[model samples]
Target: MTFPVVGMVGGGQLARMTHEAGIPLGIRFKLLSDTPQDSAAQVVNEVVVGDYRDLDTLRAFARGCDVITFDHEHVPTEHLRALEADGIPVRPGPDALVHAQDKGVMRARLDAIGVPCPRHRIVADPADVAAFAAEGDGFPVVLKTVRGGYDGKGVWVVDSVEEAEAPFRAGVPVLAEEKVDFVRELAANVVRSPHGQAVAYPVVESQQVDGVCDTVIAPAPDLDESLALHAEEMALRIAKELDVVGHLAVELFQTRDGRVLVNELAMRPHNSGHWTMDGAVTSQFANHVRAVLDLPLGDPRPRAPWTVMVNVLGGDYPDMYSAYLHCMARDPQLKIHMYGKDVKPGRKVGHVNTYGDHLDDVLERARHAAGYLRGTITE
Candidate 1:
């Protein structure tokens, strides 16, 4: 039997982590990296150095692969279509990926599909933003660049027309939405296979700081069981509707009125599902590979009653080696996954996962370890 070689585009930590998952399954991962120093390139043995933006570069890199997938959503749709036309399998194909590529398109499709979502519109200018805001509570609207945004960038919670200028400066259509009075953020993660098989993981509560994910609590504490199942169903419906054949992370906003509204969608493995690396029966990285390859999926059930994942944002401390040693000595059970990235302030360099029957204990262990890695927690 010939093992299918999967070629992943992008050189970030996501690709690096996915390559790790492919190891045990005897899967060969080929990567197209922007630079030889890129995170995935450093570890993935088959590294093709090229820019994904150039059609020629992408064409050459995809030639020998059994299938191609992405570590990011930035690849141009036309290029993917070109590859698809040549009989190259592109998991979560370009048609479905476009929704994740552009916020406006995602919102429009979600509305059309009857998925619960926030009231949003594509506004031409800041004045148009105010016009939409007026239809609601007025002012303090959320503005986002229609495309090319992630990790807290390209998003603005504008309290006034002047505050909305930043997103407009991006020179892309701005998506204006009513500022949701959300109780907390949640993520419903699901994986779908090319054969139409699918599975949903437990809904997770995600906490953000300046729009970047900081911590995640799996099986969000005391979340209404019916609502939890509804979130999962919505995610599954979305995958089927969009023809998404890989991991889909639906970021949600649970409002003060207790309704779950779709906030964002990610076509690839997302930060919100990182808890699954150690907490679940199968990690998102592994499922993404299996899904893209049309293999039978692994289980999504959690290994424990509660799992807490806390991101280790880069701080002044660059000595992760020292921190890791200390954290390992302190909580031997803690599972820390480092990205092999250079430390930079506020960048997600790694994460720590801890699972236990007690929520507080699990959260503390994960948080303390992550904080220590960031050199924030002492004693």
Candidate 2:
């Protein structure tokens, strides 16, 4: 049978990498982007420039495609539901999409399902922050906007009641949560199919700098077997609970007391899993495509004993291509991925990944190469 064409919403880097995965699977990928200069548009030829929030744009994009999925969760829920209502196939449908769309909705649903999470209170107004602080854990609680928060944006730390009032004064809807005292941050990833088959990847440790991820160590260095198993179990449980028919990324916090608390969720391919592209037996982008296409899930095993990925921030390099050669010359084993984006301060330009039989060797090489790219080292 001939493979079906995949229609993807959003033409960002995730879609660009997904296109790379689709090529090997013999699947056609069509992208819907608002601009011609989007990352995926530069790589994938089949694209329609349109706003994902517009039903007319969506209808046109969905036409002649066998299945619909997303690069990001920014699509209007009503538009997605309308597509389904019109008999279009949208994977990880509106029911599952909502969890990624609105953090408030996700917190409530996960809490109802008895998922482990930090104590939180919804603040329709900034005053509720002080009220929650008084009742719940006080000082240094996190203030986050329930919607449109990502990569440290829309999140703030309130040391006192006065600090919580800043967002309200700015007209932002915020939610207060007890600031988690965690030992480390971990990410569990899994992909589920429409057939109910699912596979989980090894949980990895993520290192964040000022709310942006800078590095990732796969299999999470010094991870206890029990904790690793627990993380995978938590990921599997969430995928099943949400009935998600695509890749799901569960961000977790390992508390000081050895308990893992749910931090956040991503229903699409996540930055934390980018190491899998050059490290795992099957990349998340490829698995997501297979899941949404209703194909059998691929192996989630690691190809090597260890894999480490370091993100390259845009501002660190004067010329990305020049830095690329310098890094590659030093460590040829390092695999570098450069997104076709203009260099800008604090933007994620690309990543470098290293894999090997020895975990230390992989990490050492990855770090050195990454540091070189960032101009932290001469060699």
Candidate 3:
């Protein structure tokens, strides 16, 4: 039997992990990376080092692949459309992917679909930002670049028009949104196939630090049963509506009034769903591969009552390998996943997952292991 080759753009850790997931299914992957040092390029046997922004590079990479997908959404939308025009299958095609690539487009689409989201609009200038603020709760409005922003970059919380000037200086469209007074952040992860089959993972609480994901707790604690179901249903509905034939993570904000509003959308395996590596019956990466290949979806059920995933950020320690003995000895059940990248302060190097019946224990184990790996915790 001839197995299909999946072409993934962007060789970040997401691509690396997704490649790993496909290994078990005898699925081959071809990666397009910015450089040979990129995370996935270092692991994927077949890699083409080139820029995703160039149409020719993309065309060259897609030639022998059965289907194309992504690890990140930064690829130019027009390039993806061109690929689709050439008879290449781009899962989460340009039309559906634009929502993930541009914040303004996403908000507009969500609004048209009657999907609850933060009040938002495109701000032409700092004055328009102030006007947007005045229309809502006033001042402290959130400004984000319409495209090319992630992990808190290109996003700003401005208290006044002067503070909002920087976003407009970039020469990119800016979107102003009412700053939501959310009690906590939640993520609803779902996977869908071209055949319309879908699966939703348990709603997970996502904790962010400095605009980057820091930790994720699966089956968000004390979540009302009905609200959890609503989150799952909403995520599934979004995947179907957008014609996303892969993983879709709906980043949500649980307002103080118990309402959930959509914050962001990720059309790939997301950090919030990383806990599934050891916690779920089917990891998001595996399901993503299956979805893109149009195969039957897998179960998304949790294997344990509580599972916690903590990101391992790079720190002063350059050699994290030295600390593995201590972390492994401390908690034998901890699962560590590290990207083969050099350590740099504040860079995401890897993550740790811990699952058990006790939430507190699970949380502590995951945090400690991640901290130890990052040189934040000793003894």
Which is the better candidate, 2 or 3, if ranked by lDDT?
3
Give candidate 1 misplaced runs (Cα > 4 Å): none
Residue 217 lDDT (model 2): 87
The residue-level lDDT of candidate 1 at 127 comes to 86
Runs in model 2 lying further than 4 Å from the true structure? 169-172
346 Cα displacement, candidate 3 (Å)? 0.7
Instruction: State every prediction's TM-score relative to the real structure.
Output: 0.99, 0.97, 0.99
RMSD (Å) of each candidate, 1 decimal: 0.9, 1.4, 0.8
lDDT tens readout by residue for model 2, 266-297? 99999999999999999999999999999998
Computed on alpha carbons, the lDDT of every model, listed in order, comes to: 0.93, 0.88, 0.94
Model 2 lDDT-worst window of ten: 165-174
* Backbone clash numbers for all candidates listed: 0, 0, 0
**Cα lDDT of model 2 overall?**
0.88
lDDT by residue (1-379, candidate 3, tens digit) is 6899999999999999999999999988999999999999999999999999999999999999999999999888899989999999999899989999999989998898889999999989988998999998899999999899999999999999899899988799999999999999999999999999999999999999999999999999999999999999999989988898899999999999999999999999999999999999999999999999999988999999999999999999999999999998989898999999999999998999999999999999999899889988887
Note the residue pairs that clash in candidate 2.
none
